[model samples]
Target: MDEGWDTVEVPARGSDFLQLAVADVPAGGKAEWLAGRLRQAIADGRLAVGSRLPPTRVLAAELRVSRGVVTEAYRRLAEDGQVAGRRRGGTVVVAVPFTTTPPPVPDGGSGEGGVPGTGGPGGRGAQGGNEAGGAGSVRDAGSMGAAGSADVAGGLGWPGDPGDLTGPSPRERVGGPGGPYVGQGAGGPGRPYAGRRVDRPAVPRAGQGTPRPPGPYPGQGAAEDGQPYAGEGGGPGGLFGGEPGVEVFDALRAAPAAVDFTPGRPDLTTFPRAAWLRAERTVLAELSAGQLGYGDPRGAPRLRRAVADWLARVRGVRVEPDAVLIVAGTAQALTLLHPVLRADGVDAVAVEEPGSLGARQHLRNGGLATPPVPVDEEGVRVDALRATGARAVLLTPAHQFPTGVVTSGERRRELLEWARDGGLILEDDYDAEHRYDRPPVPALRALLADRVCYLGSVSKLLAPALRIGWLVAPARYRAALVDAKRFNDLGNAVLPQLVLARLMESGELERHLRLVRGRHRRRRDAMIAALAGHLPGARVHGAAAGLHLTVTYASEVPDTEFAAAALAHGVKCQPLSWHRQSPGPPGLVLGYAATPPGVIAEGVALLGRALRELT
Candidate 1:
């Protein structure tokens, strides 16, 4: 009583795996409350794409609750495609579905803010209030005649289906209760009437309609995952089922296990912690105030120079520092280029068969169709590429996805010729620096600088959490691409760039690379050995270099189903079928870089068992 009142701290009880403080979430309806909060955050753009969420274990520990509860909450989000599981990489916020209903306004007469009232046709008052059906009610509507007039035109006349307003289709209404409505015509008798169609309301030609909304899903609202709906003719609901894309990485990361052989991940344990910490400290100590503020959209000069030097030394890609654009990662680089290339009148891009599904999805999301260019033992078939009319192509020339085949010299020459003849190449030199085989193949960017847009990142070398990568484009497209980058995120963080520069320039990155290469080589060999020993019919490809290997099974089982069965056995690998646009033999892409030899062996053994079970 004598002293000033002291504040009483409430101990936090974790509900969600995030170990969210009770203060962060109120009591009562906790799950719904937490879900709504997360949804709101996503809609408001608080959590951007590729944002890693706290592990369920850690979050559960913080909230003082069972891990299952957190997982369940995350699963709900996953079902809605709001979050996804990426094995080894942890849960990442890939997307958030956007759904916002305008708030109601107080009124007998329509409010002046242009807000439409929720009251139905009869001006039905708020629920539990009187249904204003009297003749005077029309007067009430007429009193605010101006506002009501617009509402009449816009209101319940089936507010244009967000899907239909964007495009037109050939499927006629046939005959239904909701007569003559083009797309959402009433189906069976039990089907709820969507809206009454105005018989002669100026229907346009078959292709007529508003321009499809610009997003992953053209002509429809952007699903949470940033893809568009498939449209009326395509199927029911919108693309991604009128929801967001599922967070694949997050779900995989949440799965508990001792050994994980998931692909495309580097050894995080080998990160140069001491070097990074030192670099961070040094950068912070010397950082100018201006440097701490918004930075050059292209990149920090120091980091770009460091990256240019590093690329020259490692990947053999020579470039001026001015040409380098720092991005969130290669993921963003694809997004930036997708629109650029599309605007340049390029409609389609050919990709390697059994390539990275994610990469193909990214290009398709940008509105360009991806034609599959078959891959042989050498690399993508140049002859096939010539057959496809795609003016641009995305390639993992250094070490191809799933199948680690480097582009052979002849094929590379053919590709260069194709590009020289006005084709464009989006080179994803992923995992090029981590090779253990023969001398490195020169990056396609090096040989065809004018036609290639090169992408590289530390996600496979250091950690994806860094969210750092570089893009080097031809001079003709550099400025527009930089503007796109600027509009994308105003450039990546400066401090991280500086620290990365220190790591690269000081040779800390090279040292780390040397260390991980040996470990990964052992892991890769162990996996190959396990495959040879256990699954004799399996053939390995791209084993000489890269963190992952593609193992093709001569058996008849579909690769996607094989992957699902493998997941059931507590082993996860991508089915070869998932990456192919054209039909091919089934296989799996297994990553060994992050796992130890013992774990790699176990995972491969599990895979062999899964394969046997399938057969």
Candidate 2:
């Protein structure tokens, strides 16, 4: 009788969706118990950004409570701006409680960590902090979705009027008299808030606030998917070898420079906000129920179709929509292609010696080898590529990455012949739309669609925060790439795709392109003129078209150190060494589109001063 088990399990309650502990609540506090549990879940990170909660009815059924109780709880959280209910998308988390560890106590201040009675930051007492009138941080949050209107005060559905922070707390308002269950009156089956009357602060109407114009999301920059631009600390020597992807942006953002010439940036301030908002409203109004769910990994069908048409009309690349596979951006395209390329008997990819360091890193990280090939004025040296014996190669053909050289007619022919010889070409058509001096060139994919895996994105055209791109692969590799995309995050978010499709179909995107091209051209001319006036000895390259100017110095100085010095002088630009795999002359890649004309001139002047001190 003594050799028995020691553990006993309690019988499970309602549905699996309702995560609750009945024993934790007192005898008559079901509504309070549920509301407290939801707040705790949000604070403890059990529910994160973009997470959806169960419907009010379903949750009420699970907890075995009247539907009014669940509705009341959700209304309280909505007032706090922690969650918002989308029409069909359900209730989604919009913001989280801002908690931080208390900083080291300053001298002459109270020795106590936090408030007198409450524990320090993140303590149990502060854990139940209210949204309004609490001694805690309260920062603005980004937009939730199409269901929630813009709230200039803070997050969607948050309490208080614009610029007013002294409003009563949402929880306090709910717990006050005549609230959810405070003065419980037998109001039949519904009407949770229709209990006995008492004086209380009025609740702000849903989505009520002064609306600010829509634009890119907060805390993001041009040419980056939320990562900072390359900084003084990030070059060829910094962590991750200054990979040209988002990491470089992270480093650049960390620098305290006032003037930035970080290349590959379009005029982000000129983003078509009015047009985008119009398109978003149209898409949301027409969105079917199925559109809100998981999407095709190859991207939304509408976007793929729109992309094919846009490329054909604008870039001289004609292809059917079926051949297009939508991706997050060029970075994600490379990621999905790596495994496919490796499995196709290709172990190494040849890159231009002074090629994109980030592209090389992506390939290498995917377990493939990257061999350096040389690049000259004609473009990537075809003869050098043959010497490397690599089966695949990555090239920025429309406009070369740093040098911005257009692939010559002869060079293009030779490369197509090479592709015909069983070699694969990954053509990165980056920033080819902003050309100033010449007519647009036909994409290599347009000429030899079967031989080239073409990649293009809206990063340079609009904002990188959109994270939308397209990939066109040879027929043989298309299926594998599609499968790879399928298993990677279940595809990009659908609403943006649908909205972008609407913009493209409506000709707003084309209008935006025409608008930015003129702005970018003016900025380019300003930078070129500034370079001539400021640094006469510095030779500028790639000025014909593209967003940046490359200046090569004949001195044998390390570009990394030169760039770091320039950063110290309150200017930030990428060193040429960061993009190269082989030894090259000391040079700096200066982006022009981001800065205004005056700032461009000033940034170049700082570069000139930095150069003088280096010598």
Spell out the clash pairs found in candidate 2. 228-249, 228-250, 229-249, 229-252, 230-248, 230-252, 231-251, 231-252
Q: Candidate 2 — worst ten consecutive residues by lDDT sum? A: 212-221
TM-score of 1: 0.61
lDDT of 1: 0.58
**In model 2, which runs have C-alpha deviations exceeding 4 angstroms?**
1-249
Q: Candidate 2 lDDT, tens digit per residue, 1-615?
A: 111121111111232222232223346767776777777656644454555666676556435568898888888889999999888767877898887953221112221222211122222221112111111111121211211111223211122221111122222211232222111122322322111122211322332321211111111112233332232233333522222333455556665689988887787888888899999999999999988999988889999878876764455454567789999999999999988987787776777656676786677567665666655555677876775567888998756777666666566667867877888899998787766543344566655666788999999999999999999988788899999998888889999999999887665775576567667766766776777666764555555567886776545455776787788888888877667543345578889888888888788889889888977
lDDT of each: 0.58, 0.61
Where does candidate 1 stray beyond 4 Å? 1-258
Number of the predicted model whose lDDT against the real structure is largest: 2
- For residue 148, what is the lDDT in candidate 2? 14
> Model 1, range 1-615, lDDT digits (tens) per residue?
111111111111222121133334445555665566555544533344554555676455445455776687778788889889888766667776765753231111111221111122231112101111110011111122111211112211111221111111122111212322111112322222112211212322342221222222111222344332122122112211221222333334555444566688887877888999999998899988877788899999999987776664445454668888899999999989877886788766777765776786666567666656666545677876776666888898767776665565556667767887888889998887665433335566655567888999999989999999999988878889999988888889888999999887665675576567667666666676777666765556556567877666556665655666677777766655455543345567788777766777678788788788977
